[model samples]
Target chain A: MEWRAAVRVTLKPGVLDPQGKAVQGALHAQGFRTVSEVRVGKYIQLALTAESRREAEEAVERMCRALLANPVLEQFAIRVWPAEQGEEETP
Target chain B: MEWRAAVRVTLKPGVLDPQGKAVQGALHAQGFRTVSEVRVGKYIQLALTAESRREAEEAVERMCRALLANPVLEQFAIRVWPAEQGEEETP
Candidate 1:
């Protein structure tokens, strides 16, 4: 079966995030005064073939640990679902 | 009311994504051969004050238009909800 996984990698608590601070400043300058803070991170989408949903989740978790996220400074969350028909699959 | 917004900004179809391609190659090299493709994008979280949910949605949409996304090459999706208690709020 074909599966789609969405991985969100975010900075752990107390980690300094200069990019997020910069974005907050920009928003405030643009008159978005109510915006108190901003945090920036990565969203990764993966397409792969797996035998079942359980198998897919396991693979995605392994991938996240191995390459998608830094265990010390970042945390990752994963969501997986069966791929839908008509979704683009690049060759 | 306090609100939190999650913004996902992704490349539109057919926009060249070299980063995605590189990650895909790296995954294959690591021997997880079932991986077919990958797409990388930005995930941004915002903590803000709004009068109501409707107001928060409108503000987030405007933010997307003004800076969060490049409409020519990317598309953005926004999810907003009330801030949960105990969530980190940087002073």
Candidate 2:
């Protein structure tokens, strides 16, 4: 089966996120007064073949641990679904 | 009311993503043969106060257009929900 996964890689809390802070400052300058906080991270989308949903999950987990995310500075979360469902290809 | 929004900012299709390519090359070097392709983008989490869900949606959309994403090279998608759901705070 073909599977698609969306992985969100975020800085572990207490880690200084200068990029996020810069973005927050930009928003505030633009008059987004209601926005209290902004944290930025990486979003990765993968398309691959898998035997089943469980297999896909395991593959994504391995990918996250090995390459997709930095375990020391970042943590990742994965969402997996059938590729044919058509959600992965969107911009 | 408080609302949380998650924004995904991705390169428009056909845009060259050198960072994604680097990550993909690293993954292939790691022997993850099943992984066919990888695309990387920005993920942003926002915590803010809003009068209602509709208001929060509008605010997030405006933020996306004005600062959260680069409209020329990127597109953004926003997912909004009540702040108390507690799903937004995970690592």
Candidate 3:
């Protein structure tokens, strides 16, 4: 089966997000408030084919650690579309 | 209501991901294959509160354009949780 997944990688909180800071400043200058926090990172959607969910999850995790993310500077998580049958998806 | 959302920002396909390339090179040297591609970027998860779904989407979109994304170099999409109670979520 082929599935679509979205992956996100971000620097840990308190880590310097110079780029994010710069963008935050820009927004503040424009009079936008209610944005109590700002962090920047990449978003990716991939189409994958696998025989089992376990196998698919493993591949995505490796991809994140291997190249999609920089553990030395960031942390990441992957969200497979169509929530798993029994997962709690808080809204 | 407050909800958890994830944001991803990535260079569009074919745009140069120099950092991704460097990491890709390193991974290959380490003998990991099956990774046909690697694109590096940041990922973010947020906790948000809003009066309506429209308000939430607007806030997230503004955040993306204002600080989370570099329009000159990348594109992004917002995925709200619980799939709007009836949205399609392909797993």
TM-score of chain A of each: 0.90, 0.91, 0.81
Please report, as a residue range, the 10-residue window in candidate 2 chain B with the lowest summed lDDT.
B82-91
TM of each candidate vs. truth: 0.92, 0.92, 0.61
User: What TM-score does prediction 1 earn?
Assistant: 0.92
Give residue A13's error in model 3 in angstroms: 6.3
Give the runs in model 2 whose Cα sits over 4 Å from its true position.
A88-91, B89-91
lDDT of each: 0.86, 0.87, 0.62
Highest DockQ: give the candidate number: 2
**Least lDDT summed over 10 consecutive residues: which range in candidate 1 chain A?**
A82-91
Clashing pairs in 2: none
lDDT of 3 by residue, A35-59 (tens): 4455566655455555666776787
Candidate 1, superposed: residue stretches over 4 Å from native:
A85-91, B85-91
TM-score of chain B of each: 0.90, 0.92, 0.82
lDDT of 1 at B87: 45
The lDDT of model 2 is 0.87
